[model samples]
Target: MTCDEAQILLHALLDNELDAGHAREVEAHIASCPACAAELAAQREMKRVLADTKLSYSAPAGLRARIEASMPQARPQPSRRSVLRGFAMGSAVSALAASGVVAVVLRQDDQQRILSEVVSAHLRSLQAGHLIDVVSTDQHTVKPWFNGKLDVAPPVIDLTAQGFTLVGGRLDYVDARAIGAVVYKRRQHIINLFVSQTASTEHRPPKTQTMQGFNCRRWGERGLNFWAVSDIGGDELTEFVDKFEAAMKVNVEG
Candidate 1:
């Protein structure tokens, strides 16, 4: 499913209006596209915001009783003016709720899709026996390799002092955009730190997620998005994120 097609039917997918097979394919495409995932999140947030908004209008005491008493079962119901006013109010509320549902359904993919891509990339690299392009332990050597390949060179760090050794690096893709993946090792486990240049300038701490038994943590800063994926423990993976972010700061200053 292309991005445009998936986007067009996002509302249907969100509302369970699509068949299972088609929904799966659309979800698969979204899983590999970061832009779609973020868009999906925004749509969900809009739905939640609408849901949280409370609209209350209280009628005077005995209002219901008065209406019931004034009604004539055999004759015509309440005055046309009153009936029309009630119908109008009911239709307005229904319309607002329906619009909220539509807004929330727009672009219905979420962050889980991005996490799936991260895990898939890591597993594909290991299973296909094609991992790194530049095999080197020196940060200086590995960092320079991306100079001509990408618009910005990802800062490579030698975290040997922290027990994560720099192994190599490679070019990868996410959401149709080329990105850099720096390889690392902790004991026998391999860590693939995926970095992509984005318009996002979020400096918030990373969030950890387990995708297919692998623990991954991702965060963003100064238009750069990073994702570290491996089978390593969540605690250890978090430490890795902290060290990497600190190294990023040092590299920026230097």
Candidate 2:
């Protein structure tokens, strides 16, 4: 992870809000980075000091009695039927709102979990001997490498004419399941395009996300989910995906 990305997540790590996967990723980065490690220590010290400091102020013992005494003597009460109707309406509204909130939270948690896994897999692939199980530039040669290796092999597109060269392919684990990673190279930057089969055949437009200084463009099409991750610029990454998708369409039609 980059220092900048680690900085943004340090507080979340300290607050214990990050999920186990992300927490471990951030902690691993900090272990190797002295600057981030020092910053985390400082954050821990500050939190400890704040916990020890007492900032609450108590009101006078009779403050509640005085406030009650100053209230109007007479007040009107709603009818029992009206009160019951209002309570029922409020209960329904609260239930709807709570359900909506829970749905949103669950979606966010799932997204974060997947993203953390993708980033970790990408990092692991960078290590020597972990990159490609099959190394070849020809799409024909690379595409057949995954025969029987996975339920569905990812499309290996030869984008060398478009500036992104086909490096090879690899098998990686994401979200606890094996997936195909079609590796590509943009100049010196490596892009790992992770593909996994999805139940949905619906199409999802590419959405860009950044994690630990790497740009990831993810989308779904033709019952497969794609995550293209690299250190390249966002625009370039988008262009890569666009060209890739276009090429895939051409191959499918031709």
Candidate 3:
């Protein structure tokens, strides 16, 4: 789930009012994301602070009922100040906590923040014309350049026969991990296939997501994650992903 959706449901989440599925997704995202987890921790602290306080207030039960019974059937709206003044200490604490949680959510959108960083790096590379640290169409040479630079060497393939030409390779950091960017070209469009090692509990079908105006298609294979991002059309990008996967499978099987 996105952070905005999580924020809207946070109060319900705190109250234990969210449905099971949504609660699970939000909790999983919160576990993966530190900023959101910190927000959760702050809210928990608020709850702790409120819970620890000794609040003593006993309203004469019948007195409020007796006053309401005597009032006319047609009620008048209370003044804004009166309403504000009428809130109890617990209500004030809740309001403050909700406001603080919303503020934190608005300030730190973890998912989009990471995506923006990835997209920015891509844009910056193109603008500065420094897309590749190692330049070679040959995957052997291009892949070996990563030695002593990064922990893992990303699989580099030449997709020229499939109309996606291998340009070269570059090193990039995205989603808090060091990754190898295998550059490809479709017509004049640039496709950056960022590869990194990430473990997943379950293997699922690849999915495409648009992030900050760039299309990113991500999938997992052989214990590594591949994220291909480009401004190229979705259909074409999907084709590229398909051929790339097929090529990898061939390389593995061969």
Question: Which candidate number would show the highest TM-score if scored against the true structure?
Answer: 2
What TM-score does candidate 2 get on C-alpha atoms?
A: 0.57
lDDT of 1 by residue, 23-49 (tens): 888788889999887777777788788
* Model 2 lDDT, residue 223, Cα: 96
- What TM-score number comes out for model 3? 0.55
**Distance from true position, residue 254, model 1, in Å?**
4.8
Displacement of residue 89 (Cα, Å) in model 1 is 59
lDDT scores in order: 0.73, 0.80, 0.71
On a 0 to 100 scale, what is the lDDT of residue 58 in model 2?
57
Ranking by TM-score: 2, 1, 3
lDDT of 3: 0.71
Rate residue 180 of model 3 by lDDT: 77
Which portions of model 2 show Cα errors greater than 4 Å? 1-108
> TM-scores across all candidates?
0.56, 0.57, 0.55
* Better-scoring candidate (TM-score), 2 or 3: 2
**Candidate 3 lDDT, tens digit per residue, 1-254?**
77777766666788899899978888988888787788888887898898899786655534543454465522122233433443443464334323333233354576445554555556546655889888888888888887655555688888999999998998775644456788999999999888766566355567887654568787887777777888898888899999998998899799
